[model samples]
Target: MWRIVAAVVGLYRMVMDATRELFIRILMGILIFLGYVLLSLFIYAIMRRIMVPQKLHTLPVHLQYTPGCSDIQCPFPQAELILNGGKKLLSSGQYYKILLELEIPETNANQEVGVFMVNLTFHSTDGRYLSSSARPVMIRFKSFLLQILYTLFFAVPLLLGLWEQKQVIELVLFESYYEPYGDGALSALVTVQHHGVQLYSTQLSIEANFSGFTYYLYQWPISMSVIVIISIFVSLCTCTVLMWVSDVVRDYDEQRRAALQRRRMIQARTTGQAAQNGLGTQRRGRGRQQVGSNTALPPALEETTGSEISSEETSTVTGVEDLASEMGRGQSTPPPSITPTEGSVTSSDYSAGFNDVLSSLHTLSRELDGQEVGVANRNIRYRTGH
Candidate 1:
């Protein structure tokens, strides 16, 4: 089972690898095709430079001057010698047909004419059917140079755009974080048009439009470093404050726990001491009981005076009552109360003693309640059962 699983995994990996390779190859092929197209265009441009002349031949300058002529003159001569019997008259100005031959190697000085009226005609060398014209006007050699320069300038960026299209695509895909922009072919042509005037009713041949997207990237190390530094500083400060708070809270909790533990220990010790004292009292009581049992006392030879007996009884009861009062008020456990026997104190005396003890306990409870109220007013915290 393990072997089969391993084989399947290996096959999957191989397939994925092959697919990735194919994708990469496709991208590279696109790049190669783009390069080839650019190279071809560049070569074609170079060949055109060699094969086509920098200046085109000046077409034959055909013109007719009416007898009376002015810059704005339009002479209506009578038609006399017409081929179809339409009368015509000789109405002309100084007629000089200067064919502005835009010769390469060297330009003739007369090739430059200014402000003279001129007509244009496009025809074949065989003198076959073509356009006829009888108007003369200004011409300038600089116009030709201007046109050539403009055309060349426009052509450059266009070819460059074509050449770099693949690279541009790749850059856009992979380095999307960078901004890319260019005018491409259209921008080149617009730049060319800006250079010269069109005389022959120009028709633009190429149409190119390019669009690009912009992206942001870190340019300055200082700015990036500053942001990072600020972030780290803020984090460090935040962490420090948190840690300080934690430490303070931890210390406070520990101290509170320790205080509570100490209080409990003291309570425990006091309880144990109270238990021991109670045991000692019990032992003493047992001894006293033994002594009483062993000796037989003679019957009272003479009755004691009523006042003396009363006073004696009163003193004993008072002592017992004082002991009970102390036990009740102390908050800690006290020795158990000893009940007087039939021969001892009366019931009325015992009741009075118990009333005194209860009174004392009520007073202590009031005092504790007052202390609790005071603590609330002061916002003071103290352990209970202290």
Candidate 2:
């Protein structure tokens, strides 16, 4: 029983983990789908909004049956539209064409549409006459739906490729450049004319598209100022962010360079200071070595120095006594000189030669000691043995 329970628990856990993973995957897929759908809808809406051209339209007006409209007679049910309103503009700087649509929605049966005529007149913002276009819409078929479909497919393309629109859009009233900044008004007129004797007297029996068929005009859509402003704003923002980033990078580089330079300076100063300390320690050690060994001379040099000192002492004593005696007796005598010896050193042989000066001082002292002194005295001198 325990084994069965464990197996069931394991199975349950496994199933739960799989279910959780599946749920997560499903949720992610759903989110992605929703995001894609939303983006598509947004793009579609914007495209539709941008693709709608500046248009001039009016409420459909019934064209009263008559002998028909002629240029010599007044056209019936003229449609007028304002260019400055929320509707599509009727301004200049673009090509324009007029199309007439006839409909017989009240009729249950289909009837043939005969020849018709359309007139489009555009006026400037000051109500001044600008341009006019008149064309007899002579083409017709048994099927009104087919006619609408054909025009929808090829109307705008035909207008774009043809330069005949320029013939009607002559005279400048905000011309030379295209901008969504002008205002104007235009009128659409349509006339239903019979073709080669009216076969069917029932005009309402014709099946046609019932919408504003007579007022439709074609014009190319243009982008508004809002899109341009948004683009400029985005560009300025990007440039500002880039400039700020450049400044930050430059400042960082400068600070890093300064830190490296300071570090190098510190290293150089420490190195020089260490070198000076090393030299000072070496000089001090050398000075100590000189001090320690200076007093103890070699055996031969010690004996020589001692003999030189003893010989000088003896000479000084003898010289002083003789000088004293000579002065007392009113006679002068020369000072004694060092005899040549193997171990003795002479004044001329060494750097330290103080014996002569000491002897002179001694002689002077004896003369000053209340003795009549005569001036015939010489300094004791030393001679080294060859």
Candidate achieving the largest TM-score: 2
Q: Give the TM-score of candidate 1.
A: 0.24
Tens digit per residue, CA lDDT, model 2, 204-310? 11011211311131121134333533454455556768999999999999999999999999999998787666545543532332222322111111111112234
- Relative to the true structure, candidate 2 reaches a TM of 0.32
- Candidate 2 regions exceeding 4 Å error are 1-48, 51-77, 89-97, 102-117, 128-130, 137-181, 184-259, 278-349, 352-386
Which runs in model 1 stand beyond 4 Å of their true positions? 1-224, 291-386
Per-residue alpha-carbon lDDT of model 1 for 7-112, expressed as tens digits? Answer: 9999999999999999999999698656655655555445433332222112221222354343333542211111111321111111122222211111333333
TM-score of each predicted structure versus truth: 0.24, 0.32
lDDT of each structure? 0.37, 0.43
Consecutive 10-residue window with the lowest summed lDDT within model 1: 165-174
